[model samples]
Target: MARQVSLATQLAQSPSAWNGHIAPLILRAMTDVYITLAWIFQDREKRTDEYVKYGLGQRKLWLEHFKRSLVERGEKEPEKNLFVKALTRQLNAERFEHITEVNVGAWSERSTRKMAEEAGCLDLYRLAYTPFSTAVHSMWTHIAGYNLRRCRNPLHQFHRVPEDSDLEPDIDYVYRAAKYVAKTFALFDRETGVSVETPSSLDQFVESLAHPTGEAQTDSPDPLDDL
Candidate 1:
């Protein structure tokens, strides 16, 4: 969760990540991480081991895919593959190669939506999970709107031509990222009943941005800033 929040903060430093397209994608990823941690912490005793198992299974699946890819590329004797053997040893160091089972399936053996529902964050799944896949999968609903623009020529019948237009940087992305981090910390605090006496760096950053001066401000932020 901390790593994911750090990634979101790093993304906020990028102007390109301030736009509607890129920012939402990163926000969605953070949202996913939030959901995953929320679910895992619910049953740490059992879920942590499950998480490790699934993670190792994924690594094994990847290693298998790498070997298959090499074989498909007309590489004979991929068994003695140098990189594969090294990776196998590394993974074996964690657990024996024969011990971990590969699962060509979801991490929890359940849909993300289901997990989110159980994790009490169905809203995150609704808002962040499926909708953001458009930009990733290049769906018409997303690209047809964001990645296309009208032609200037009157002779072209105002047809939409594909163009990657530069969008104005929005501060809302930073806030959203902060909110996700806040939500994660809130969850941790609620479960553990222990939090630092001082506020988190994100809390300070947001409060400072929301109230630049030392005094507290009650006014609403700019409407567009919330977008």
Candidate 2:
């Protein structure tokens, strides 16, 4: 998580040449790191068989998709049946009859959101992780917010800005991402019996960004900040 956040910080600090395109990428990376850490912290013991099952299911799904595409393209001949062989081998290794078995039936109750809830970091998922997901998927929610201009007239008022006029750089986001990384690191450390030691400046930097002097921020502070 620390390394991922560090890379995002570097990208954010670099020239604003790709701010519009890169910011979302950074946000998604941060969100992934946050969720992955939360999962590790919440399921250290046996890591919840469901999570393992979910991962195996994902692998099976991809392999099955690949096999189907190969068959459709007429590339499933005995000599060129690499993907089919791979799928079969994977299923056999996992002791599953087919990909359908891996994907079907009752799944684990523990989801990404559930991990966050169990880890006491659901607010982080709600505030940042979910929004970042839309950005990652290029959903209309992200497109309409960042790409379209707001106007008074309801009809034909929205105009897409030129490529050159992309989003301005936002340093505040970098700070918040860093803070989330720090908190996630602490959570994992505490859960794993490791003492988290942040740099002397980390708390002050996060606080300064969170509450600029003389400005009242309504956002509730992270409880982990006290640590």
Q: Rate the local accuracy (lDDT) of all candidates.
A: 0.82, 0.65
Model 2 bad stretches (over 4 Å): 2-21, 78-101, 104-108, 139-141, 150-164, 196-227
Give the residue spans of candidate 1 off by over 4 A: 152-155, 211-227
Per-residue lDDT tens digits for candidate 1, residues 7-110, read: 67787789777986787778777877888888888788788888888889888889999999999999998879999989999898997478888877887777
For model 2, which pairs clash? Answer: none
lDDT of 2: 0.65
Residue 170 error for model 2, in Å? Answer: 1.9
Instruction: State the weakest 10-residue window (summed lDDT) of model 1.
Output: 214-223
Question: How many clashes show up per model?
Answer: 0, 0
TM-score of 2: 0.62
Choose the strongest candidate by TM-score: 1
